[model samples]
Target chain A: MSDRTDPPGRRSTGKLIVSYTIVGVPLLYGLVATAIKASQLFT
Target chain B: MGVTQLLDRERTVAPPGYNRWLIPPAALAIHLSIGQVYAFSVFKNPLVERFGSSETAVAVVFSLAIAVLGLSAAFLGPWMERNGPRKAMVLSAVCFSGGFLVSALGVAAGQLWVVYLGYGLLGGIGLGIGYISPVSTLIKWFPDRPGLSTGLAIMGFGGGAFIASAVSDRLLRTLAPEPTAAIAPAFVVLGLAYLLLMTYGAWLVKVPPPGYAPGGYDPAEDETGVEARDITADQAIRTHQFWLVWVVLFTNVTAGIGILEQASPMIQDFFDQVDASAAAGYVGLLSIANMLGRFVWSSSSDYVGRRPVYAMYLGVGAVAVLTVILIGASSLAVFVLGTGLLISFYGGGFATVPAYLKDLFGSHQVGAIHGRLLTAWSAAGVAGPLIINILTESQRRGGAEGAAAYRPSLFVVVAMLAIGFVANLFVRPLAEGASDEDIGRRHRAEPAGSPG
Candidate 1:
């Protein structure tokens, strides 16, 4: 759904990256932590 | 005037050429913060110790939060839709964070009632408001891919608990000499952190400009297996289709909780070799499955269609539960995989429903309709766990061992799924005559002046 070809004011790639980062970093951390904990199911 | 004017729907409309992709993350921020309610169990033992109360008494706090979440969501859904996501989200942030601060004071003062009023009532309102705040807006923005867009945001609700569980556990450990002593401070820290994060969501979110559709998108080509009809929340509830959908959600959730409510103990009881830590891992794995499934299954619904996808969740999900009973009891792999699949469907059921409602009732009042429908969840939350607990305790009292103790409840879960499947079959499109004009006339008659 990228509007890359849209006029100058339409593109917000920088803001897009920042927005994803705000929620993504914490989500990644939680996923890794949960994955580590879940590894105990095998061991 | 300043803040009020800024938060108005007209003020927050997307500027020309604004990318819609940014909206999901904003929705995600609010969902993730409020999803912390799922992790309230982490504080159970600490609170029990602090208040010198019974486990049931401490447990009441979480129950109250969830019950309130459903009730408030059902009642305030129209208000959120009227006010727009930005203002609703800001209100959610304040009540949610304010809940923590109030609860912290309650903890310090050794008053359990204060904590209930803070976390349960106030925070529950936040959860309810935040949960539905972005849904209708997301549906509007991504009309071509309503399922995928709503799924992206709702997925945060499932994943939020994992983040909260780990973060809250760590905070409890390091914040004070004893975890119980740290409860108040942890609430403060979490409250502040959530406020900052949720505010970012409120700031970033914008409603799509009227008549805006993505380039290359056309409504005539829509293919979700149902013709669209704009039905207000009031009128939507009066349809048989609405209650059928409600039953679909209620039964799906009730069945899933049959496994989740006692994941740790159930696994250990199924296998002699499994310990608390291994069971803990199993629970974590289920959380991952639940989180991922919300995104995967709901996005797939955009293609597979909402009705058929729900059929799979209910129909195939029933088979999974039965498989768990027949062979899963003897095999850990079967048990884990079966229950994990069930839980994924459970989460998927939640994430997919908004799009499902949009398909059935149209986007105009989907959020409010969705809000009213969540009362089913509140009802199921109480019924599911209560039924499982009672059945299992009875089995244990009867001297049943290992998997035998849970066998009866598993059968009940399968039955619940079967019921949901039947309900799914009954969910046909809104009858051909419920035209937009007819619904609009009814809405205009109502005195509330609530926007759809």
Candidate 2:
């Protein structure tokens, strides 16, 4: 929930970015890695 | 107060409901029983002997089970929060015990897929649900000592393996000469026992009473300042710090799982030039080290704060893995000690992380974020073992001598820990404006003299 009209101090774009990066990157990495590993498993 | 006022009040403060001490024992019951999953390797050796299965094939079963643990938790978090932990615990008990029953039948009938579906899929769902059920509740109950409280619950998870190893070993010996046949009866008995124990734990679990706060709490001294705002589960997922933690956990768990999955073989390979009995003993020692680390290092995090504690884990873990590679099995004592420290840090990483999450995001929807974060564990469960297996297999094929086959794998773990250390460095207190009203309520409910 972004405080769109709020002043910069009240808003936390940095926190939003950090959260996305923290969860998103690893999730992507895990998915890619799993696909690779699963392919190896079937092959 | 009217319903809206009551709801608003609860949004800020804890609703009166349950005992705090009951949480840890409940956690212990579930964790200690589920810890059997880690001991699946014991079954691995036996299965290969009985069914003539490949090591990779057997390992895939364990991997699948662990993956399901994470996936199930992601979905189960909301339900657990909605219904309270009692229902969740009961469900876990049934699923976990029933899984074992199914697995027992699978072993008796010599159906490998049955074992996978039973233990891997069903039992994993139990693990996922049981794992997260207590975390957020405990944090709410002990907002003053989130790290210590969460650590106590998770420590049981680490220690559970120790109990499983001993019990499973005895059961295997008594039930049948072969693992497949012996494992069936053992699974059946263990499943029944865990069902009863976990049900009792679920019965004991209760939420804290409304407006109650931990005694003698103080806010100023807490590592994360009271100025930090709470964030909801959805809002938490939107933050960069959340993803940072995901990476941190992913790397930390993957590195540890790498060593854990291959511990026995790694030890044996390390001392290939030495006595076989000694190698086996080294594996046992590593288990002891891993179990002890959960309590020792995580308890210490209560005093040191989470960042510094994780720094120790990453730094020490890196050195330990490197030492294993460079030492080349020369000194048994050095090898044992290094591996012990590495295992301790591994356990500690899991135990300390819940508190770290509380510090970063406040206690609001911590359960959900923690659930989401567990996806990293699910990923690592597969990644670590696969990497180790592939590397070791290739090395063996290439005619690499003994422990040398393991060197590259150790280096990979080292690199993972190094990355984890960098991520730990980036962790800081959450900003003031970001925390939600729930944290304020939790803070306000505390006694006047208590720290926020």
Candidate 3:
């Protein structure tokens, strides 16, 4: 029964961008490393 | 915003029409970052040479960290429940990543004790908190599919090594190739990176409001035949079901750990023709199997029911281990397939347990209860390696050569699994009665806010 509109902070687009960026950096690293390793496997 | 304000649960409650899918990535962000603990093996050779210590001494660092992880999670579960996920996550981020930073400084100074305190003690605590931080919140957001929802997040923990293995190796090589000098700077970089990543998970994570359920699902009609009783972590420990699940997790993890710890060596020892490189590749394949099983098997557990899924995990896992012992040396396919299935169940076991807890005890403090149960993981982590390492060494001394050296040890694991299977069989559902939350609700009579 506690349903209401989304809270104030969650509304900000900037917050989403920042969170994505933080997670994105490591994910990008992981992807690049995978790509390099995969290329080696093929070559 | 204030620190507490930023982490406040009321603020994190999902809005009407909010997509539940977004929550898993938030969990993944934390789990994957913390999951890098599995990839700590990449640093082994370097640490041995740097501290001028034996490999066993260096391994103590990893073992200590895992031990502390379980300990802190058990103790900190309630505190986290009180503060909510975002706060716990931020705190975990600081401790986990900060442990690396502190350990880096220790390495730079050539102080092994400092490394233990930072990486082992501090970072381990961070890992425990980061792990449980998102779980309760995720369950709240996706009550309709507890197994699958938790699986998606927990699978990230399994997959963490896949990402970390390649990346950590590259980071180590680029920043400081010399094993002795490389560890400190590499730790610094990884620590900072994880700090950022875990913080993102902290920021992104949210809990659902009281009585929240996804659209189109009625909790009352959705019958898993489980009582809607809320049990606190303290109350849960009093139940036989909790200990049964504990033993189940302990035995399953022990079996899996024995295989994992011995992965590369076991394959090589079993067959003379397979070289180290091939064994390494095989280990990688097992890693893939392990990661996939987390998602596939655990998600499937939703439909299959928690107890049967575990029965399958322990029962089939025993068979697979037995198969490896029986004809693994003679046939490579049998060895890989058996070990692969075992590995999948290993990952599956970890992923499925949270949902299993939700089924037995209501979601009301499921996170705290899950945290308490992880002590089984710590015990198994130690016990598994000890059984594998000691028995194999004893066999080697006894002149049981090659694959024969491993048989005695593997059989011991099978015995352990048989006990677990029995434990799984006896895991009776909790009696339909007043749970702790109900008692508290009646006593204090605060309209019970649904346990997140």
The top-ranked prediction according to DockQ is 1
Residue-pair clashes per prediction, in order, are 0, 34, 0
Off by over 4 Å in 1: A1-11, B224-229, B436-452
Ranking by TM-score: 1, 3, 2
**Alpha-carbon RMSD of each model:** 4.0, 13.5, 5.2
Top-down DockQ ranking: 1, 3, 2
Q: Relative to the true structure, how large is the alpha-carbon lDDT of every model?
A: 0.89, 0.71, 0.82
Instruction: Name the top TM-score candidate.
Output: 1
Q: Each prediction's DockQ?
A: 0.49, 0.02, 0.19
True contacts kept of 3: 0.13
Q: Residue B184 CA error for candidate 3 (Å)?
A: 1.9
Per model, kept true contacts as a fraction are 0.54, 0.00, 0.13
**Candidate 2 root-mean-square deviation in Å:** 13.5
Candidate 2 docking classification: incorrect
User: Which runs in model 3 stand beyond 4 Å of their true positions?
Assistant: A1-43, B225-227, B435-452
Kindly report, for each predicted structure in the order presented, the TM-score of its chain A compared with the true chain A. Answer: 0.74, 0.52, 0.66
i-RMSD values for every candidate model:
3.3, 15.8, 4.7
Error of 3 at B107 (Å): 1.2
Q: Write the per-residue lDDT of candidate 2 for residues B60-107, one digit (tens) a residue.
A: 778888888888888777667666666777778888888899988887
